[model samples]
Target: MGKGTPAFGKHNNKLVHVVCRRCGKRSYHQRKKRCASCGFGRTASRRVYAWNKRT
Candidate 1:
């Protein structure tokens, strides 16, 4: 129950897992929006695109 630790049973606020574009390695990041492994910021991360499908 320390600071930054994921909560138990569905209340977890852990750092999100993301892949670094520059280093191609997986890392954990929070609102700071930077890769801990390579020091790459959010701009160097992968882009996410959402598509809307019409029924």
Candidate 2:
């Protein structure tokens, strides 16, 4: 089971709210969007991928 954000979370429920680690703002992090307080971009995965894989 995914211990992360819940599915169908935002529109259906409003009980869960996560504070941005980067910015201390309360927001429904079920969807991807820039922070309302700060312009920091948040993503689901914390991994970085390269455009081209070259050895």
- RMSD to truth, every model: 11.0, 11.3
TM-score of each: 0.42, 0.34
lDDT of 2 by residue, 1-55 (tens): 4786675456756534467566676753535554443444655443234643474
Candidate 1 lDDT (Cα, 0 to 1): 0.61
Query: Which lDDT tens digits does candidate 1 get at residues 4-45?
Result: 757466664554757766677776365667776666775555
Total residue pair clashes for candidate 2? 0
> What is candidate 1's CA lDDT for residue 22?
69
After TM-score superposition, what is the CA distance of residue 18 in candidate 1 from its true location, in Å? 0.6
Clashing pairs in 2: none
Highest TM-score model number: 1
